[model samples]
Target: MALLSPGRLAALHQMGATETRVLQDKPSDSYERGYAEDVDHIIPSPTLFDSLRDQHLVPDDMPAISQCATHLELLEVFHSLRNRVIQSRYLDNAFNIHPSKRIVYHRKHRRQKKVGKELRDTGFEGRREEKWKYYLNIATARFEQWIQGIDTAMNDLEIPPCGRKVLPPLDVLVVWHAFLLNPADFKEYCLKKRLQHVQKIIFPWREIHEAIDSTTWRFTVPADQAGWILQTTLLEPDLLHTLTEDSHINYLARDLLRNLSESRWYNLAANLRQANDRQSAFMQTIHAAINNQIEHRPLVENVQRQCIFVDKMHAHRWIRSPAVQGTLTRAVDKYENFLELFRLYPNKFLVPTLDVDLVWHTHQCSAELYRGFVVDRVGRFINHEDNISRGTLDTGFTSTEEWYQLRFGEQYQVCLCWYCEAILSAVEEEEVKDGGSWEAVDVEEIVERVGEEVEFCRDLEISRQKGRRLPRWKHGAGV
Candidate 1:
């Protein structure tokens, strides 16, 4: 039986946490209904498993007991679980689930079209890069404030770590989703900031979606919960007001900072900076800066420096570019090859550049497809380990570069961009100086934290699919 931690149990008892009432949902939209139906149709039958068993595709070490089910049978169970998770987390209208990359790419395209048109309409005199940067600067600054708001909510809720929940605005959720895709950076940022709630808080995605109506893009809080939330947090009681506040943008974060200071929400604005003295001084400086009317460029640069998410957002912009779009198919092909390399040598860890990683992320979004792909091609479940240290990641990347060159007769560095090149060179230089010290470090602590499924001792029997060649790319990726 599972046991709760003493601290958590006490928190739950003190807070009087109640089970959420299951509210009946309204009829789903056409797209949502269709998607749910499609998922339901994918559920496999025992007869299908029997055919696979006859074909020697699955292990048959157990009798037909639910507790002692075959591997294929377990797969069916997990598949059904996944369907339930999707239904509850997504299709049930509890939370606003952001579109996958497939759908999101189109949304991004539309956003770009809007931004470009706005630029033209305003007669902004700048290069294409400058125009895009202008938009990114505003967006990232807004995202930084949104993160602070989330922190405020998390800290205010005096409940167990996992029990505290806040509904993020849809626009904020979009940025947060991108931030999470780079798991290492995201985890490290939260840990470094001592954001325990941010790190451990359970996202009631369906609930958040339901709270925010999809058609109107408006939000509502349950009347019973709203009172407590308003009293405990800095947020407005009416979620519509919070939504409006989130929709507002500030390029230098001047407006947001002023509001925080005015409300005496110094701790939240200071971002959990531990020392009382430091927090006070920081808040004073911010207040003085606002009063003095800080220069635009310096404040913008400062915001950019403090915003850890800007880099990933910038990287995503490049990924969504037409050049990357042209080469996406090639990147997917490379990603398959990367998986095949893992299949060939299961003991070693590998790392992908941003381009290939994008493809890997998209595949994993479709849980069923990802499982099938890895099982058929790699012969085992290839888990994506997100929490990794920089040292470990660099080592894996360097090793992958060498292995890829030897196996594919090609350089592993796909992007010729200055930032990518700098990273590539820095890793190589560090490797030379350290003399492969990373290999000597405790790998389990730093590298990919994989599960017991990784078989290193013996070649496990696999239902390998027929191999095929992917078309070669004439151009480099990660523009």
Candidate 2:
């Protein structure tokens, strides 16, 4: 025979009284309540042994024999006799069903409704009952497992330092761990659950820094959750400072800064002093002189009015200051030479004395020259009086005699003033018509013309060897 512990006996007696009161005060309308109370006593009977067994609190090695069976039957009788007490305490008060079990119940009810409609429509009711039983068994098993899980989790809860005391809610611990795993999802769950006034514990900065540096830190949090973490904790500072100080960090700091600032992480801006400083310096140098002369003129005037204004004589004296005159002259000369070269070959050269080949390699000559000269020439050529378009010509005469014979006639004498003058004037007119634009002419045409001229000169040389002496040619003079 097994003896009950004092505590277990007390619990059983308490349950008895609670069930007794529930039965005595039971309303006539609640047949299910009475039925449930009877079922509780019949199946997992609410006796001390039954309660111990259901709770898994019974020790092993207890014999299931005649005396034990007698004890179990007697315990079942006691549970029925004390039904009202158990009903009041556990049956009436507690839902006596897990939430997962409740969900299963609703699901089964829906499935049953669907199956009932189908059976009525088809007149096939044979499998309906079987399906219901199957679903019921599955639901029952799942409910039991869910309850077991809950019990195990409860058992794992740390005992208070002082005997049995109320522990923190299990949901709170769940939320904390969920936040550890994924703060973003946890935050959403909290919002959906309407858990108001939940005070989140702020993690220590060093711990957070370690988490970030570990390379395994989860970045799955939603933007809002990240914003919350940054706002409530020191995460923003740690992240901003880490990225700011890291030499290997990419040029994405600006983007990060923008995101942080937009999210109201204003403190991060403080750590970006160096970046801001560099940007300020660049802006100042790029637009400073213009800004000073125009936008900030009032301030400039104020400074000039307040400070000593040096006259031209004083400026000259300052310019001729022995301390800097030599350096200044050398710098000015270097700058002047540079400007001249830039004007002459604006695209090809930056510095006058630098080797031409170096500048040619450094800059594109055609593009620069076109930009500086051709663009300006377009406007000038449109306004010019001489309508002569640019033309290309090539000549390859070994002697002046060949050139004269080609342009004038082979028999033409220098004494023919009209012809000679016309030829000279035509050459002058051609030069004037060109507007001095080198790019306007066709280079290919010029090369072809030069090749033809070279061949003609060779023919002329052969003719001279054959005793065909061409006269010496001149423009507007004796031939």
Candidate 3:
């Protein structure tokens, strides 16, 4: 397996698919004849960039795109290219269908029986803490595969260098979605890998949301686009079959899976027969330390960090509990206010409550949707950065809390969990000691401190506000 480069395997895969298609069409009894006819189809298909550009040759022929058309609309219409009409409709849709809303969408009958079965087969069924360990391990492994698969596909296949992107399978998409939430980390990963397809990759958020057939549970795309995906990536299993029958990839490229299994860390984490009690505890602590450093690092180096938090939350039902109804509703309301806050003070470094963050993260899972929704409302792209230090987060959260309340007449620290409560208390105490107030965020200083943190920050032309402090709210006994 090691002898065959990914490119060679890709060529073979293309030939095999071409041969099968020819045989099906020709009803060939002779293998030789079918193989000979397969030569024509094996020629590289036009890249997605070419296909999209060809589709929109006549502007009049293009379909009516969403009013909130931003990059998503541009990619759909001009294969490249926002609006105010989009503000109401797009914002409503973003909040309404954001991924986090699905956390409790059908959890009542799904959790203990269905979800448990899913995790059970993945070797994560166990005590709460222990389950986190196994879920993290499997998630991390899958993320590794995704990164490699994308890199390999881009290098080997004729995927567009900068255009509409091909979607990966759902498991890979989950981790990819999380990774893309941190734009800096995602871009750094691309830059470090020297990946050319970074510009070409665009998630089709609108298409997926609108085109999915509920009865079939299938995302319906043009047959050409589906064929493009089959030709370009290793995501061959039927989407419906994947959803209803098995969430696991039973037919993953054997060599790639073998290499993943051979890695020492993956082997240690996945070996179900090993002494897991102590090992899981040890690995869990190590995972925490690793996450601290890799919070905003490249996916290749930080797959564990990328997957662990998400998988851990899922394992504990934090992201999928039926009790999430009110929380998600509040999240949507708060997310609307959060966007409004940004529109009012576009230059401010306002932090969000956990509820708002949840909604924000969900919106971002679909990159096209997020860009269109945010750009329409805020007049610029808002990158959700999580790589800031604890001190920075505390200060920003505290100041943002006050500013949000002042602007919206609502409390921002809504989560009553012990962890959130403790953090809020500490930030409030620190503010009192310093006699601090909500000051305007230093746009230049922040940009310089975090290089390329916001890809479009410099391009957008941030307006500097006067350093006037907002009215302060006295906490507990006055200092």
Candidate 4:
């Protein structure tokens, strides 16, 4: 930057290039910046200045830019002709200008190197706590790899091994297991550590507090056994064992099953979705048999029970909801059944009584019909409050990638993918994404158009308010 032409430097500054500035006082050429101290350079290249001026059309801001470089006279005019040519080519891709193809998009992101590749010390006579982390990393990595369907630890339950030293407490490891497993839902540190509340059954409070007191000497598990051990503990609880299935236990088991590279869940999810498409109820009932394979039944039951309770309480509001149009009466046909079942079995029953309008569009006609319905009806529901299909309108188009980009800008594409990912049947879109384009709508262009529309709408709002026409600039200043 110091060697750039005065005009070029000022133009960059105007276009928001970062420059080192002296806060207290402007530093002189002699003032030492640590990074510059070791560097060596050649004499100013006069040809660069001439070449830059000749080949590249100089910007209008060059005069002002030349003044900005007044203090940088001693700065060498740097760069080879090729480098300068490449550099000067993209100056116009500044703010408020739509980014150009000339500007680099999709850079290869740099990531920090992973840990635990280094060999651990042979002896235990070291910083036990610090060494514990080496093993913790191994355990975490194995579980993560397992989750991602990579070759991982042998025991589905255990953490991987590290060096010869004390390990992190079982409590913390269990929390990590839950976190790495349920990346969503259990996001908060406090919420995750809440699972540490379960650790008391395996390692008592006295032990946990002692580990806290002397973190360095804490007893750690083998990296491989770390994950497996938690599952063993989950199996150990007699009280939870009494239940046919427990929610917490099911959740932990689900995480363990996810990392099982040998497991057929992913293949089944894809295949079962096909079976589900042909006959939704058949697949829905068969779901119970499938969850038993992964021991995930309780988690599903727990979520369903919760939704059922909420729906039961809010029956009047949504049973004949203004938010849903079709078959309002038919959707809650089970309302009478629900009342009878509740009388007999209390809270043990759930009658699927909502989202009737938000029908699985695929089931309605065919995949094509669903896509058409999304593009037409669901898209129209965007700004219309009176329109039914609230649940469908909100969650449906999101899977298609249109609603997200329309409501939020292109930057939110990642967030939208994460949000509607579970429901997205990428039928064709998956291939489109792999080919480097997923969006049907140009989000940035849409945002600009929407902004214009909003500004136009403001005129109506302004007209409703009282205002007097006045001079563009009022004169009470100097007078």
Candidate that scores best on lDDT: 3
Error of 4 at 304 (Å): 12
How well is each residue in 109-143 modelled by candidate 3, as lDDT tens digits?
54454332222223212122222222233344444
Off by over 4 Å in 3: 1-165, 187-230, 235-297, 300-303, 306-329, 343-348, 372-376, 415-479
Error of 1 at 81 (Å): 33
State the lDDT of candidate 4 residue by residue for 164-207, as single tens digits: 11123332333232232222232333254333221111112122
- In candidate 1, the residue pairs with backbone N, CA or C atoms under 3 Å apart (3 or more residues apart, or in different chains) clash, namely 94-206, 94-207, 94-209, 94-210, 95-205, 95-206, 95-208, 95-209, 96-209
Q: Could you tell me which residue pairs clash in candidate 3?
A: 162-200, 163-200
Better of 1 and 2 by lDDT: 1
Give the lowest summed-lDDT range of ten residues in model 4: 70-79
Q: Each candidate's lDDT (Cα)?
A: 0.38, 0.26, 0.40, 0.25
lDDT of 4: 0.25
Residue 463 in candidate 1, Cα distance off native in Å: 54
How much does each candidate deviate from the true structure in C-alpha RMSD? Answer: 23.4, 49.5, 26.3, 30.3
Q: Which stretches of candidate 4 lie over 4 Å from their true place?
A: 1-296, 300-479
Each candidate structure's count of clashing pairs: 9, 11, 2, 16
lDDT of 1 by residue, 1-479 (tens): 01123443343333221211111111111112222223221211223223222322232221111111122122222232222333332111212222323212223565464322212223212222232223223233344444565566666745432222454433333345445444455566667666655644433333443354321224455665555443443233332233223333111233334343233333445543433443333334334333333322333343333233334423233221222222343555577778878987799999987656655654443233445657887898776655567899999999998888888876566542322222233333445667964444332321121111111000010100011111121122111
User: Against the hidden true structure, what lDDT does model 3 obtain?
Assistant: 0.40
* Model 1: lDDT of residue 466: 13
The alpha-carbon root-mean-square deviation between model 3 and the true structure, to one decimal in Å, is: 26.3
| Residue 35 accuracy (lDDT) in model 3 | 26
